[model samples]
Target: MIKITEKSECCGCNACVQRCPKQCISMKEDEQGFLYPFVDTTSCIDCGLCEKVCPILNPFDTKEPLQVLAAKNKNEDQRLKSSSGGTFILLAEHIIKQGGVVFGARFDTNWEVEHCYAETIEELEPLMRSKYVQSKIGNTYKEAEQFLKDGRLVMFVGTSCQIAGLKRFLRKEYDNLLAVDFICHGVPSPGIWRKYLEEIKSSRSEAAGKNTVLSLSLKSVPVITGINFREKQQGGYGWKKYGFVVQAKSPSKGDKNSVLLSSIFNENIFMKGFLANLYLRPSCYKCKAKNGSANSDITIADFWGIQKSHPEFDDDKGVSVVFIHTCKGKGIIKELSSRLDLIDSNLKEATLPNPVYFRSCQEPKKYSLFWNIYKKTKSVHEAVNAATKLTFIDVIKIFLRRFYNKLRRTFKMVN
Candidate 1:
């Protein structure tokens, strides 16, 4: 019963697909590699359930958070492995200890991200850190609903739009369900992610020369064993200057040395393209879940400007900016206080350096240009360079803008 005339009308959350009792709606990928709902008109019974469960059509009202705080896990090793303050792991662990399930995004064997649930603390490892790609929500909503109906405590964490979709699909709220989201900086296309991985494998094979088994056969292609979007082991900047890392093993039967590839956030081709807003879904530019519209109980993100406001808490390791949106969220924070190093903070300071918390990322000027070049060259690196490289005029404009802002700030300080 739902119609998507424009790509921006849908967030590709897969809510409609699961909500349809007739199972008549299927998600089909477009040329841009983003999924859109395709209803089987002949089979659809017009139950109108699909329309009723669309987050975009029935968005929650924007509300201010009840509490804002800076928090980090007390466990240093866990913090190191996490993308931010490692707060999510603690939260997930708490739920698991209570014999509950935690749902989150994790990479599959093929390195594709998907929504999955974990019941044990050990199972929560894959759900840690960030995947950046828009994960396929394959029957996760239905699974979560089943768990909720079974009276099991459940914690669901994902991008805000995903949380919104799940909430919409469920319709009625469950007391035992805890919905958590992040300050999302638009999800990139999974199609582009697959392309980028292929590019990496091909380039690595060429770099290794003739003796490498990677060039032998399609089956001997290197298997990506691990991928870290926010590798915190960078020598100088620690968590603040996280790196992208990919680890792989050649299928040579005997050779076991793993190849490790890494790059800083700015230098990584895929990260560059993602940060520049080159290949994000069209709906990302006009996100319906911005400004607390997802109605999540708790939201978490990197405390980007913690050094300026709480320098003592900024040990160069990651810190989380947490927004408690409801009484349920506050209760959880209290329950976890002993395990977290919590520092009181205000929302204005928390959101100051993290604009994605309130506003969606604008599409880059070279968004179309990047796709055009990629379509022709099939090179992620080339496409990213074409989209992100600044010209002389652009550099000049950046300098002038910075100078103007500095001058205004100085004037206000003097007054």
Candidate 2:
């Protein structure tokens, strides 16, 4: 009879909700619509299975670090369309083509990040673009597992946290289930992401002569181009850098939806205040998914190293860094080889920049100081201006620092 009071410690892992044989424990949404788990005291059997399976009270240790083909900025159509690399979509397409279900994020009616099932390539198209928010997972894994049990292939793509949570929930490995998790920065809360989009659309409306399509991308801006990824090498774990411009192209222009969401909410999304809009549960900040071993079949990120190494690559064209985690992952890459225009080269030699913004551990707090300054004001327009005014000098200074450190490291290894 584990009474879950407010005083009792809970990690919000949802294990108790799943393990309860009575199905008493369920997710309860607060006024803000943030889902939190609660127990139905009347149905309590006191079996303690909930206590045993709780990842919050008893977190699992990362098995071991395994990495391969660290790439950043892989140039390809799918990579360009993806948030980082084109791998997720490629993997999803293959699974869906085989009559499997692909699960990922898509914008809901309110433009909030919500998980959806993609049964066709057209369904996957909308999901291809990165939502940059912690997408609502509405029994997606539970439903996918049922499909997997039906002897159908199911491919699920999301942040490391989502993948970890799904694997934790499923417990047993199913051959039909293919799990692909992003090598990601933390996801922004859906509420914050929605707010950011609202502000972005409002501003973009002001920018465009009239309002029309809700679209945004980082492609036009050169300063804010590089995507991040994990790069484990022969010597040790390090960063692999790649640069690509994410062009924010809207299908149509609208009075209310022209501004870039990332540009507007860039401050909060990067991290600030008591509850940074971008964080998942508090534990995600100290994620066990940090060094891989996240139970993901394939781990992928933006191939950041490509732009410099493969100078011929068009920045807007897109690039992705793919990591093959298991046999399935290797198979995915092998399959993609035909579809993707790839060049086999060690990322460090090919495109590893001097310093990476997100992957490298040497520098702390990857975001610009604008995040703190924007927190001083609540106006989303002001935040957009601040982001717009972010001088090239400031970005260059940070990039230069990272560059010099990388140069030093490269020299040491080369000598």
TM-score of each: 0.94, 0.66
lDDT of 1 by residue, 270-320 (tens): 888898899999999999998888889999999999999999999877999
Error of 1 at 72 (Å): 0.9
Off by over 4 Å in 2: 1-19, 28-34, 51-67, 70-79, 198-281, 309-316, 344-415
Which stretches in model 1 have alpha-carbon errors above 4 Å?
204-220, 234-237, 252-254, 257-259, 409-415
Writing each residue's lDDT as its tens digit, candidate 2 over 111-209 gives: 566787988888997787665556777767668878988999988887765776677777789988888876665554455445544544444333232
Q: What is the clash count of model 2?
A: 34
